[model samples]
Structure formats: structure tokens, C-alpha cells
Target: MALYGITEREKAVTVTHAGVPHPDAECHGVVAQATQNRVLVVFVSALQRVAHPPAFADTDAEVGKH
Candidate 1:
């Protein structure tokens, strides 16, 4: 919770199990509260964009119209 900058957890919980979020944890009990590091960890679910790989989807165009 370093102002949303410093956090890399893999279950070695510490910092008194972090804090500041417990609104009835849900997502797997909020990742089990980060093994007690409370929360602020988002393993995934945040990529509104940036998934390139369709520069033409199997290209075959050269300014045509059937």
C-alpha cells in the first residue's frame, strides 16, 4: 500500500497484515486477506486495453472492395 506503488506479495505476509480494506471481503475472501496482509493486492483484473495482435486479423487487403 505504498500509496499504490510498492507491493509484491506471494504469501509471506507481514507489515502487520497490511490494512484499510474489509468491506465484507468476497473475491476468495479477498485472497484470504493476503494471508493476513489485509488487502491492496490485485493479482489480476485490470487491463481495459493493450492486447494487440490484430493488425489485420490475417491480413489480405490492398485497398480493394471485393
Candidate 2:
């Protein structure tokens, strides 16, 4: 889970991977920081609702343990 800070006034998105400013898309706010576990949980939950991917079922349990 990579953290990004998007500046609407400058229309730029900043990430830890690069020092260069990336042009922002149609977005409202920025994410200053995010935890890998939290992001993965949300991702897997969405996948479960839409695709129900088999691999992710096990991961759900693993994530809960953590």
C-alpha cells in the first residue's frame, strides 16, 4: 500500500516512489498514508463481493489473524 498526497490546487499527485509530480486525474482528496493491511482488506473485500476469487478467500482468514 503506497501512500500518495494529491494536491488539487497544483493538480499534482505525489508518491514515495518518485520525486517528480504526477498530474492528477479526476479526484477529490488525497491519501497521505495508508496501511498495507487496511488497503489489502478493502481490496479483498471488494473482490469477494464482485468476483469471489478462490485465492482471496484464504487470504481473508489470514488477514483476520493479523
Candidate 3:
């Protein structure tokens, strides 16, 4: 993915269990298929959660603020 600066081809595979995304797998596809800005946005958003802890009591008003 663009976030990783690498190219990868999608492969078909059968899965028996629930498939989960990896923390480091920021982008789903190859870098060539993504824009630098899009990658940066996702990266920044992930970092924001780390830098700022979420409110314990989240409400509809809080969600609307963003």
C-alpha cells in the first residue's frame, strides 16, 4: 500500500475463521493504488487516537462535535 511504499497483488483464498486486519496494515491494497495524501490522512488519524485519549463517556453530542 502507499502507506508502506510497496506493491502487492490481491490473492483469492478461502478462510474458515473470522478475518481481522492487522494494526500495521494501514492500507488494504498496494502503495501504487493509493495516493500519498490519503495514506498520510489515515496515518495521522491513527496517531491522533494515541496522542489523545478518548472520553470515557461518549455521547451523541460528542460525536456531532467532530
Candidate 4:
């Protein structure tokens, strides 16, 4: 269960898209792999950390209800 520095504990990975949890794709006994030439690598930009460009509505005095 060990290869390419993947320990037995890391042999399994929770299903995710761009590192975002995807319960639909999760499966027991599934094995995930990482390769330099494949699309298995995922990079996620934290939503709360992302800086969205300011919009004109940001200046509006009225705040929208949640």
C-alpha cells in the first residue's frame, strides 16, 4: 500500500474537485494516484482568501438581506 512516498494512511483520498469536497464521488476502497503528467493534481484557492474585484454596487448605501 506504499508507493511514491504514499504511506498506507494516504492510500485513500476523499473525493474532491479542485480540492472541494464532493460527496457524490467519494467511495470506499478507492485509490487515488498522483502523477506529474496526469490531471490528478489539484490546486484550490480558498474562497474566503480570494480577492474579488470591487464592483460599483459595493458603493450602494443599501445592503442586501442575507
Q: Write the per-residue lDDT of candidate 2 for residues 28-59, one digit (tens) a residue.
A: 11231233366655664554456633323333
Instruction: Kindly provide the TM-score of model 4 when superposed on the true structure, using C-alpha atoms.
Output: 0.14
Worst 10 residues of 3 by lDDT: 9-18
What TM-score would candidate 1 get against the native?
0.15
For residues 1-66, what per-residue lDDT tens digits would candidate 4 score against the true structure? Answer: 334333332344322212222221221112322234233323222221243222212432243222
lDDT over C-alpha atoms for residue 65 of model 2: 47
State in Å the error of residue 58, model 1.
29
Task: Report lDDT per candidate.
Answer: 0.31, 0.35, 0.37, 0.28
**Model 3 C-alpha lDDT per residue in residues 2-48, reported as the tens digit of each score:** 44342231122112212212222334323323555776666666664
Clashing residue pairs found in predicted model 3: 1-30, 1-31, 2-31
Candidate 4 off by > 4 Å: 1-45, 53-57, 62-66
Instruction: Candidate 1: give the clashing pairs.
Output: none
- Top-lDDT candidate index: 3
Ten-residue stretch with the least lDDT total in model 1: 44-53
